[model samples]
Target: MREPLLRIEGLRTVFRIPGGEFAAVDGVDLEVPRGRTLGVVGESGCGKSVLSLSVMRLVPPPGRVAAGHVWLEGRDLLALPMEQMRQVRGSRVAMIFQEPMTSLNPVHSVGAQIVEAMRAHDPGASAAALKERAIEALRRVRIPAPERRFEEYPHQLSGGMRQRVMIAMALACSPRLLIADEPTTALDVTVQAQILDLLRELQAETGMSIILITHDLGVVAEMADEVAVMYAGRVVERAAARALFEDPQHPYTLGLLGSVPRLDEERERLLAIEGVVPPPFALPKGCRFHPRCPFAIEACRMAPPALEEIAPGHLAACIRAPVEQSVAA
Candidate 1:
């Protein structure tokens, strides 16, 4: 088997809450093969974003990685010293945050920020070279008049354009792994499609692995080679994108799929998963999703089901996955 480009095992991150600590990311495991995209999908407040942040070692203050290893090309990122980790971040692994306005600096020109990122990785490179590379990055992301845009500030560009700039900066270093957290958030439908297409084109050219963190099933269907379905900080199901879409095992996974509007199947009402995601500090024992599971049994409320392989390359944290299918039929 080919070694994965990125591997995460038993990863846990915690936040110091007002009352106590909450495990924002709880014992999650994931991997990404080189040149493939892995979609991390879950509802809001389900720790999808935190998992990505943990991988990059950028979980905000009051939250820190509590356990597990983030392996990048056989090297353990968690064990690396601060200086080494810093070097590895923009150089080997880059992340595009959810919001561009918050991520991009208001004070600095887009060109200057990209140049700064490049310089961090390659300080020996001359200013002229960095500027040229910055323009090239913008052009690669399909920003028209790269030189003109390079001089523009973050506030000057449209939302989609700012997102492209974020992508430009993330790819400027040519990192092997790209973690995009809701990269197309808040964009109009047309802009969202354009951004997704741009990402696909760039991935094809660079062969860079991507871990897309989003709740949009449509986006996952369009981009992910594999999908990991997360709920309440745990990966409830994982499989190839096609397999997961065709045969979702976990109740939450099924509910999420049911929520998407189908083109062929006509329906009066879109399905919705009952109950909001439980607060991190108020998570229930046993299966976190038991309350919302339509087919929940006594066993579901007894104890947390371990994630087990139900088929080759497919795993789900449910004991009655087969039964659920039978019941649905």
Candidate 2:
């Protein structure tokens, strides 16, 4: 088997609450194979975004990576010094944040921003060369009139255009790993398709691995090679995309897939997973998801279940995994 481009082991990111700290991302173990996309899917507050930020080491103040290793190409990122980590961020691993409006500076022109990103890694390069390279980056993402778009500020462009610019900047440094958090939020369906296609084309060209974090299971179905379903700060199920969609083992994964509006299936109403994700500080004592799991029994409330494999490369945390077999018996 080919070695994974990125490997995460027991990652935990904690935030300070009033009296103590709570782990927003708890004990996540994931691997993104070289040139393959790994989709992290879950509803709001499930710590999908925090997991991505933890990998980037960009968790805001009062939130820190309390434990675990983020191994990128065999190097432990969490162990790196601040300065070394800064150097690794843009040139080695880049992120496209959820909101381009806030992520992109309102003051700087898009071209200058891309140029700055490049200059960080290639400071000795002449200004003219960097500007040319930035414009080329815009063109690479299929932005029309690359020169004019380059000079425009973030607000001047349409939402789709801004997203393209974000993608362009992310790819500018030719990083090996790209973590995109909700790259298509608030865009129309047409534009969403375009951005996803652009990412696919770029991945094909560069052979770079992607960690795509989003709540849209539809997007994951179309883009991801593997899927990890998260709930209440932990991954509940992990499997290849087809295996997951065809035979989800965890109740939460079933709930998520059932909730998506399917064109072929007829239903009076969309299925919704009952109850909100529990607050990290006030998580349930046994299984974190037992409160909402329809299959919960007395045994489920006894202790947290381990993520165990029922079949090759398919893992679930629920005790009654291989749920169909368990249900049939």
**Clashing residue pairs in candidate 2 (N, C-alpha, C atoms within 3 angstroms):** none
> Tens digits of per-residue lDDT for model 2 on 171-263?
998999999998997788999999999999999999999999999989999899999999989999999999999989999998888888898
The runs of at least 3 residues in candidate 2 whose Cα sits more than 4 Å from the true structure, single-residue gaps closed, are none
Q: Write the per-residue lDDT of candidate 1 for residues 34-53, one digit (tens) a residue.
A: 99999999988889999988
lDDT of each: 0.93, 0.92
Candidate 2: RMSD to truth: 1.0
Backbone clashes under 3 angstroms, per model: 0, 0
Error of 1 at 213 (Å): 0.5
Query: Quick one: best TM-score, which candidate?
Result: 2
Number of the top lDDT candidate:
1
Return the number of clashes found in candidate 2. Answer: 0
Candidates in order, TM-scores: namely 0.97, 0.98
Candidate 1 residue pairs in clash (backbone atoms < 3 Å): none
